[model samples]
Target: MRWIWIDRILEFKPKQSARAVKCLSLAEDFFADHFPGWPVMPGALMLEGLAQTGGILVGEANDFKEKVILAKIPKAVFHREVLAGDEIVYDVELLHLRKEGATVAGKVLVGAALAVEAEIFFAHLDQSRSQQFFGDHNFVFTGELQRILGLVREAGKRPEQS
Candidate 1:
């Protein structure tokens, strides 16, 4: 499944921070199986959402030269459950970045309340290696992600400089 965590980019600061949103709906596939009677978004998927947002920020910061993959998730905490009809606003800040890896701190907010917070880590790898790691796992960027990237670029007011 092509899981797109971010629905839109509300704000973006190049090499610094970004804010994006994800609207949860009952129509989403995961909700169908997560729980029958009472559905709650999975914590792992929440982490995935944060990772996706943070990875994009890192990739954009580096001009997407190397494919940024989630190498490890050193720390993650779920403060609350995200339910259908909730809009999760994710804020991510670049904590550190180097040639081989990067770290980001992210928080997911449901309205004004914090739902989840995590410190995510990513490793930069050659495209070929990344492809191999994914191993036929089809990951396609949804239109939402493209739109967010557009907004991020616009907000930054600069083309991605490698």
Candidate 2:
């Protein structure tokens, strides 16, 4: 199954920034093992949410021609624990964007309080290079990714509002 951590795209600005949210539910599988008595969202999963948000922003900035992959996480910090029923708002700002890769500064907030912050770097892989290694069907939801991020308005429609 595809692991889509973020639930919805609240807002997006091409080549600049994006805001998205994820609501953790009691049925989340990880909660069973993360902590038996006191369930909490894993820090790693929080970072993954941030990366997924930033990765989508980077990919959209390039029209999804290049496969954006997290290469390095230069910095990450968690200020508090995230629990089930918590809705996390991820705000990511692009620091730089180039042919090779991109960098972003991100923050995760629970309501008005900051929960986590990170600096992420991602490498852009050429489509041909990726296809050679992973084959054509590897990314079954490339279009879906765009749709989830609000990059694509509808089927056969041009990406809306940049």
Candidate 3:
């Protein structure tokens, strides 16, 4: 099963940045076993949320023709634990974009408190290169995510206006 950490795109700026939200619920399956009685979102999942937001922003800059993959995490820090019932807001900013890849800085906030932050690198893959490993499924999955995140219009007419 695939998991989409972000619940919605609160704001996005084509090549510059994106802001998204993820509302944690106790009903989520992972919460059952993640910590038994004391449930807190895993640090790794928080990182993935940041990566997803950054990846989508980078992919949009290229019109989604290239598959964006997280390449490296040069820096990461967690300020506090994220628990169920918390709403995490992710802010991803583009640091650099080049032919080979892109670099991004992202932060997660719970209310006014910082929860996690990281510097992420992304590699762009053309369909040819991406298909070799992901076949067509990855593209489909990404398209769905973009739609759910409101990065693309549901009618498929055009990219989000702003």
Candidate 4:
């Protein structure tokens, strides 16, 4: 199955930062196998949501010319459990950007409480390399991603360009 991590953008700033939300539902398949009776969202999945948000931010900052993949997650702290019916808000900030890679700091909050936080690093790879890396992963960059990229481009544009 395809993994759709991010739900929608709550707030966004071009080349700077973004906040997005992911609502976890009881009907999700992972809950059935994660623990059976006492199902809680996994730390790794929570981190994946944060990483997805950060990837989107970094890709936007680079104008989406290159495919960005999670290279490393240096630090991750899970402070609370996330159960079904919880909405996870991910706030990601671009720390640095280079030709080959970018670094971002991200946090996952369940309501007002912190659930998970991490510093993620991403590497920009060529299209062929990305395809090889994510082989048969069934990943799709949807229209929403395009719309977000357009917004980022517009926001990054100079007054004369706009």
Poorly placed runs, candidate 3 (over 4 Å): 127-141, 151-162
In the predicted model 1, the residue pairs found to clash are none
Residue-level lDDT tens digits of model 4 in 32-88: 988798779999988887877787778777666667778899999889899988998
Clashes of each: 0, 0, 0, 0
lDDT of each residue in 1-162, candidate 2, tens digit only: 368888887778889998889999978999999888788999999999899889889988877777788889999989999998899999999999988889999999999999999999998765336656865442633766677865423322644565
lDDT of 1 by residue, 107-144 (tens): 99998999988999888765445656665433433345
TM-score of 1: 0.81
lDDT of 3 by residue, 46-82 (tens): 9998998898888888777677888899999999999
Give the candidate number with the greatest TM-score: 2
Model 2, poorest ten-residue lDDT window? 151-160
Better of 2 and 4 by TM-score: 2
lDDT, residue 143, model 1: 45
Candidate 3, after superposition: displacement of residue 160 in Å? Answer: 18
- Could you give the candidate ranking by TM-score, starting with the highest? 2, 3, 1, 4
Which candidate should be chosen as best, given lDDT against the real structure?
Answer: 2
The residue pairs that clash in candidate 2, if any, are none
